[model samples]
Target: MSKQVMLAASAVAVLMSCTVNAATEIQWWHAMGGSLGDKVNEIAEGYNATQDQFVVKPVFKGSYPETMTGAIAAFRAKQQPHIVQVYEVGTATMMSADKAIYPVHQLMNDSKEKFDPTAFLPSVTGYYTANSGEMLSMPFNSSTPVLYYNKSMFEKAGLSDADAPKTWNDLELVATKLLASGAQCGFTTGYQSWVQLENFAARHNVAFASNDNGFGGLDTELLVNNKAFVDHISKLEQWSKTGAFKYGGRASDAASLFYSGECAMYMNSSASYAGIKENMPNTEFGVSELPYWPSVIEQPQNSIIGGASLWVLQGHPKQDYEGVAEFFSYLSSAKVQADWHQFTGYLPITQDAFELTESQNFYQENPGTRIAIEQMTAVTPTKNSKGLRLGNFVQIRDVVDEELEQVWSGKQSAQQALDAVTARSNELLKNFERVNSKS
Candidate 1:
């Protein structure tokens, strides 16, 4: 052979040798950002360090809505990742995309891992499970809405930190007093419609929709116009106009207010702990349960899960699916989960991690960290209290937002806003039902 031909042959041999034990890469698309995003990368790195047969790569695609849109587009284009992290509201949309997923239950069983859905808090697992008790998506960064307060603000406003509100009446008193005491702002919240409607319904043990908030069937309709809901919204409207409550736009806008000491209290996801820890390192904060209405049927039940889950996408090669499954297995480990829970404020889905945290006294030392776990496991879930899984829920939430804005802006009564939301959300549900029907 000539010199050039020999060199080409040598290069080919080098390339072949380099491919000797290379593992298949499993892509995981997620919607986590900031500190939680970094924690995700850390977990992925730990998993990759554990094995040579699988490499898990996490890609950030923006907020929850944008990520879902991208995933649907990618699915249609036949370029879906091996794994995608979808928010809780996307459950119905994902469940209906039957051909696009490899269910997590099957993956765990096939991988022969000691996967036990029963070990998870039912309030968390039930959100993503099929009727047959198989969970479609693995609960990853599950969070519940919690009442966060500024400790110094409380003391400055002449409130005892030991005596925060336990019910709606108590909150009204506290908020009224905080306002009267001339705090910059008494209370503020993010995701007005979500915390006030969806989670608020769950915390108050009411149905935001028929068919147990759409977990039962596709024919579900929004019933957020219930008396309890209207009352809650009306009260919030009064508080807003009275300067007792400041309305931040949508989706976690109030977190900044609390972190910046502009608002005395904030209602946002528990997952904000990592960011709060960084931004307000010296800021003293308290975590408490979302207060419930005193006239409600009962005390607060478990609040619904927030954050997102790691879902296995279909149409990938077996090797890639196996790699994805193995990566999930690593995530599900008790030690990894406990560490993640410690690093991030997300509830550990597995009982082992919860117990480990208890044994380590993480909660005892952290003070308010146990509130979420306690709230999640406090009651046996009734139909209304379990969680929501409505189809086209993201669009339905948009409907809730628009009508709610009308209520907040005094363009409509609370009842009128909710009635409009119910009508519009049902239309989306009907569309979902039609599309998912098998003819």
Candidate 2:
């Protein structure tokens, strides 16, 4: 070969190698598992395919609490991922990690990404926004609790699918009918603290904590031990005694009870739709708005969200952040967000995404898919109905679960259990406040 031809070939090889080495890998740690984990992988793959500058690597880091704990430890060791998915309850904790996080709003601004905070749903973004009106994290997989019922079980119980419970009183009646019809368990729930307590309070337009559910300041305290909460818990305890209501353990563990046809009705995150559908493909189920208490309010208030958000962590290079911003922009596109919302039952964080899904007739094709959106946007959110932003909320949820379990097991009365929960959770809040107050 001629020397000039050889030199051209060698230069071509060098350029190819430089291009391959220039692709930055962005580590993304998350808690989504099962079918949801697969979706996360697909999203990362789609973005990587669109560009060669940055490759996103998604790693499942166990459950929400576990993922958050892992990220905190990693940050302390200066080995944190570029992005970590944190549950809503951990928002306060993430916010307090001032040196460890790069606020989404700030990151977008610094990276010069065209972002409009107003593009997101107010009800969804309210949970992750700062007092200064900046978005702290990218809202992903936002979901409100909804009622899921076994259609066949309802028919066997002589209940019409159209008559799905609308109020707490109605729920009790339905549970009784299901139990009387020889159903193994009439109703069950997952994320007891989230669906039952936090959302319960929000739906009733009652306070979950003082200082506007911890959104106003860090000096907030729990107020879930009110008369309404006590009454609701007491009713559930009574149902537990009659076998009308079964305690399904914690998290989404009880989802098995509903999908397996053991329970006639289940109350869990709207995002559980994907898992429920995948697990029970042969069974027909119906989704409805979460029941509310008529005695507490003339009409039910809006429900709050319960899924995790994508938080950008600090310690990444400037170029890495540019890639992160671009990836985020792609993730927020109407097509991408709409596809995700339809597939996973998560709320389309952006209004355009929701509109895109609607325009596609996805909700009409899939019955009950829009129940969560309707529930969340039923009414203008009041301070009480917006969402919680308490410190140490994750640990507080554990306290709530523990105390509520006492009530479920007949070890403590509803009032006593709630009182204990309030006291213990307040201590956690105080500690979080002491540590993060100056930040």
Candidate 3:
């Protein structure tokens, strides 16, 4: 070959290498596993395909608590990811560690990204915002507890498939019939503490903790031993004896029971919709708002969010942060949010996404798809329903689960179990406040 031709090819190869090296890489560590992890990777791939200047990489870092703890350790070692996904319970911990986080509002402003906080749904952003209304993190995959029932099972039970139980009384009657009709279990639930206690009290407009469920201050104490809470648990204990209500462990175990047709009715996060469809394609199901108690005078209040959000970490390069900002902007688009909501059974985080879905008649085509959105937006969120901001909440939930199991085992009454839970959880609350207040 001629020397001139060789020189031209060498220059072209060097330019290609520079172009590939110039693209910034932004790492995002999250706790999503299995199919949800695939969705996270798909989102990142879409963003990478859309832009040449930045590439977002997603890494699963175990469960939610472990992921948050890992990020903390990484931060101390000066090896943190550009962003980390923290669950709702970790909101207080993240808010307190202001030094380790670069708040979302400031990140967007500093990077000159187009971020309009008002575009997001009020209930979603409220949980991760400052007292001054500044957004702390980007809201993603926000979900609320809802009722899911097998329509075919309902038909066999001689119940109306189109009608869902609006109150606990109705649920009891239906559960009795469902079990008597050869179903293995009448009803079961995931997230026992979340569905039975936290959201239950919120829907009744009752406080789960002092200081507006810990949003007002860090010195909040749990109020799960109150009459309303105890009475609810006591009723569940009674139902357990009659085979009407079944405790299927914590977190998505009941989902398996329901999807396998072992249980006729199930209560779980709205996000479970995707899994139910993917895992049980043959089973027809209906989704509805969570049941309330008809006797309660102030019933039907809003339910709290249950999923996680994206938090920006400190010490990343300006270029990496700009990539993070750009990726966030892409994720926040209405089209992306709508597709995500439809595909994952999670509530859309923005008003535009919700409206876009509505405009496309997606809900009409897919029956029961709108129930979660309707349930969440049924009423403006009260102080009790805004969402819990408790510290060390993952451990507190474990304590609650243990005490609740005692009630089911008949070792203790509902009131007795709840009393123990409140006492134990308060100790954790006190310790958290003591340490965090000083920090």
Candidate 4:
């Protein structure tokens, strides 16, 4: 070989090195902790390994509220990450920051990546889309509440593992048996306001707000104190007295109780699968859809998404935006999405990923992983059931928790507590509407 060839070879090696090592670094903020956090790292690692041009650095900032606060602080300080993992309740808050986000559809289009609004689960995508069907955020760990039962506890109480309660009536009957058989608490729940009221309203085919549950407009009202909500809370209050149900603290505090086997059944996010599997492997656990109020409209309706999505924060350099698009495209790949769903029990955001999982029999073998998907697909989600998009929803959830706590503690009747919540919540909603309109 000639000396020229040797020099050319050296030059090529240097060029390749420059491209790979010069990979754009994109920062991401999330709220996941414990085993769920591990699953997130695995996917980011995979994406980083398969690419030479981009790196996604996921940062665990804290719980959902804390993470949202951190993101806002970063943005205010002009140090915001390119992507932020915001919980579903923070949707309106994120949207209210008009210049702070890059609406995922726009970002994908600008970067020339293939994107389709119709291809995602309506129950997941609908919450993040604009009026024109353009998605504002990339659907990430979307989840719905499901009943997690300790199969060992259930069977010990003479309950069938295959038969999960479908209605509140069935839940009460089984819960009574579990308690009678010596279970400390027959049932408990995490995110009480989340599963019991927000998603509960959806499953009952009841409107959580006017204007298609806040999708059609910013002027939405609170309806959690409606007949459906009253009846459900009344029952829970009654059960609380017998110690058949344990009232966990705010923001999914019941996770500890359920994972510790303190309760026979827990209604929590289907996303909790990884944690249950990790900490309670020796315990026989079962996952099923959250029970609906049979007193409400009969039959089942769709459950809305609970987990956060990747919102592209705007106000960045053109190069940064380009890098953001590339990284997002990487996340949207069938391989990454499939593995993410398999690892985390999150609903597959893309149709291709869902099909891939089914073809591979990922769900057939995994008992509880399919429960979230089944709940999501049970109905062709209507506008009313698609999900909430109201402004200041984060604050509203707090109000729900506060009022419901009163009921749970026997300080107030369910009707009184719920009615008070409704009146107070509407004021907050109106305030949000007023401010958002001006903005």
Off by over 4 Å in 2: 1-21
Clash count per candidate: 1, 0, 0, 0
The C-alpha stretches of model 3 lying farther than 4 A from their native spots are 1-21
Q: Residue 263: error of model 2 in Å?
A: 1.9
Residues 147-238, model 4: lDDT tens digits: 99999889878989666788888888898888888888978988887888888888888888877888887888877778777888898999
Candidate rank order under TM-score: 3, 2, 1, 4
**Which parts of model 1 are misplaced by more than 4 Å?**
1-18
Best by lDDT: 2
- Considering TM-score, which of the candidate structures 2 and 4 is the better prediction for this target? 2
Which segments of candidate 4 are over 4 A away from where they belong?
1-22, 34-42, 48-51
C-alpha local distance difference test of each model: 0.83, 0.91, 0.88, 0.84
TM-score of 1: 0.92
Model 1 Cα lDDT, one tens digit per residue, 388-437: 88888888878887888777788999989888988888889999899986
lDDT of each residue in 1-439, candidate 3, tens digit only: 6999999998897578558767777889999898888989999999988978877879999998899999999999999999999998888899888788999999999999999999988888888887678999998878999999999999998988655788898899898888888887888999999999999978888999999889888999999999988888999999999888888887788777887888888999988887888888988888888999978744598888889999999997777888898899999999889989988888999999999999999999988888888887878888887788898898899999899989988999998998999999999999999999977
Write the residue-wise lDDT of candidate 2 on 318-436 in tens digits.
89999999999999999899989988889999989999999999999999999999999878888888889889888898898899998988899999999999999899999999999
| Between candidates 3 and 4, the lDDT winner | 3
